[model samples]
Target: MRSRVLGSVLFGLGILALVFAGGLAFVVAPAAARLPYDMERTQSVAEAPNAQFLQITNGVAKVDTGTLRSTVTVQPDAKTTADLEGDLDGSALVWLVGQEVVRTDTNEVVSAYSTSYAVDRQTAAARDWNGQWLDTGSNRQSVKYTGHMYKFPFGTEKKSYDIFDRDILKAQPARFVKTEEVGGLETYQFVQEITNGRQDLPKDRLDAILGQLMPGATSGSVAYANTRTVWVEPTTGQYIRVQEKQSKTLVGNTGQSVTLLDALFTYTDDTVAKSADAASANRQKLLLVGVWGPLALALLALLLIIAGAILVTRRAAPTTAPRHAHPRHAADEDETAPIR
Candidate 1:
């Protein structure tokens, strides 16, 4: 009876353990995959040396050649997070991005812009929960955003993924190029080529450039092209390093054309190291909840279940009597019968 009761306890414990394992894998793991609300803001610095860009000063535009330094930052949007409800699988991640480019030689500000958008907590895909807004110094507009932006999905695969380009305002395929390692972590390299994608400039801005670059020409536009490459840590879907080969040319209706911007921007070494460290930390947490923890619990449950089955199915050995033993009660009975 004691063994059976012990067996029942062990059996119950095994079932409970199994349930916990399932919960860790299915419930806790998914929750862990969601982006954290207090995520760290990103600070990235990159530079392009010996590059060509347009310089506008005192309402006059001119093409110049120099080094360019760019600073990009990403942080959670406070207003959007407050607006989010109990939807989106309990995740309310929205990001505000700012980019500023300046001439390294003369410290002239070349380009500056800000953008705000929403992305899924799990997949990092663009979400329309809030409106997408872009603000340049000249104008601000509401634009539709799609596909991957600053981040990638957790547990990213080796296949192609779509990443959005700010210039074209569309998502393009980022094809898998090769496997490489960054700061001792293996990563997948993806490349995206935008062949002469058109960027529609504001009419006033376009006219101003045309007036300065091509005199007496009434119409012109800028043709944009870029070769973007990224090295992504697979497990955490964090970018380790990035390189952008960008070129922009102004074409006038009167058969005059000039290079507006030509530069190759690469993330600095310090930026890459910091990004790698963050990715590694996140990867460990995800693996523990999703893979290693579940596996260990399942194995323990199997052992307990087997031990319980043995105790429950087993029977105690029967009691044995000695053959040479004689009872005192037998002698008393024999004597009583003689007297009778």
Candidate 2:
């Protein structure tokens, strides 16, 4: 009975410990993932400016890890342009310009071009733009344009002032599908389509448009299929979210493609402008999923420890006698022993 009682107590303790451990693990697993998420979020916020408009003049690009090392200046000005000097690799310079995009190497202008617009500051619609470049030494010029907007509420427009033969505008249609919580805030998701190789757009015109758009939508890898997603903050109208994805080739080697899955943009509004804490809170929630794994493991370990403790206590429990006891007779033993 004593052993049983002890065992029961130990068992209960063990169960409690196990429960505690499980809870701890559950909490820790998510916490670990959050470490990376938080780091990324903090880095992104730090790299980006808090004002309505931001400008990065003479921006320096780090080779690996894709972190912005330094910027010439940042302010709340509406129109901002920056001259970027870096080694040409894929699409790395797309995030710096709003009007004209120029690619230079070793202090020499390799290509000078402009982007056409499909949508303006206000009014939700689909917009496309192309890129046009001029040959400084030789008066030669090239233009590249790509496909029509298959999606709805989309339109195309172009502005050309140079001596280029053709005008190319990057054609992308933006539609306000719905409001979603992205990076922890309610954001409007916009879908943008680019000219796939299967479609027929003038190669020169397509190239020109891509050139203009490339600075804003930089590619991650050399493989053409890797595309980046850009989001504009609905309240501030400033880009807040940028995501990149890897693409797999379905057919021939040259038939590779990159599809934009998700992009987020935020606009300046009273909420974002008035409170800095709110913005931080939103970022934390969106990144919470990354830390859940560590929290779960910690909880599991705690549970096991609790179970072991309960078993140990059960083994250590002392035996106890019953309240009632029967008396033994020595005389009966003596009588029985006489025969022996």
Candidate 3:
């Protein structure tokens, strides 16, 4: 009886554990992968050495060569996300991003701008709503932003993904190059390149370069191109390291060209270390809950169920009763009666 009770208790507990395991695998894992609302961190500065860029000196646009640094910051917009409705309330994360480029040698500001965009928390894809530029040539322009901009989705696959290009103001396909390791963590490498894509400059900035760069040029254009590469941790979809080669050219109405920018920038060592640490920690947590925990619980449940069944079946099986012989007198009387 005691064995039956213990077995029944273990069986019930095992069933409960099995249900929890399913919930963790199917439900909790997804929720755990979401981007937190308070992820407002400033990234480390990206630096380019021996870079050439256009700079204005005494009201003249001319080419200058120096070291350049790009600083980026991202913060969650509390006011915007607080009022999200319908499918966006719990599913979307609104972020404000700002970029500043400067010449490190002369301490001259090259460019600065800010933008607002919303992305799905799960997929990290930009949505159409709440997307517009600020303080740049494209300020307040209606932009049709699509694809992954800031981060990749969790469990990133070995396939091409659309990434938003800032200069082109559109999404372009970033092809997977190969699998690589970053700081002892496995990651996927993706490469994106843009060739001769035209970009709009502020009217004043464009006007200054028209006659300065080319003679007899009224309407001019700026062509932009970039080759971007990133190493992203697959489990958390966080970038461990990144590099970009950017080039820009000024085109006169008669097709005369002048080089505006030619630079190759890479992430700082500190940034890569921080990213790798974060990814490693998150990856471990996800594995514990989704894979290891569920598997262990399932195994325990099987063991408990089998033990319970064995105990219950043994108790329920039929057994023969033992026969006993009577004492001397009773045996003699029974023997005579049995003969008749």
Best model number under lDDT: 1
Residues 1-340 of candidate 2: C-alpha lDDT, one tens digit per residue: 5555655565565566555555445654333322121111111211212111112224321111111111111111122111212321211111111112112122222123333312222222222233323232224344343322111111111211111111223444333445566555555545443334232233453343333323443222221222334344443333345433322221222333333111122223432342334344533443343234334544554565565456555545457966638666777656756643
- Model 1: residues with Cα > 4 Å off, grouped in runs: 85-92, 317-340
Candidate 3 global Cα RMSD? 4.8
Off by over 4 Å in 2: 1-169, 174-178, 193-195, 198-223, 226-228, 246-340
| Tens digit of per-residue lDDT, candidate 1, span 153-207 | 8988988999999999999999998999987789999999999798889999999
| lDDT value, candidate 1, whole model | 0.88
Clashing pairs in 1: none
TM-score of each: 0.89, 0.25, 0.89
122 Cα displacement, candidate 1 (Å): 1.5
What is candidate 3's CA lDDT for residue 143?
67
Who is ahead in lDDT, 2 or 3?
Answer: 3
Q: Point out the worst 10-residue segment of candidate 2 by lDDT.
A: 68-77
Q: Per-residue lDDT tens digits of candidate 3, residues 1-33?
A: 767887788788779889988988999888888
Error of 3 at 275 (Å): 1.0
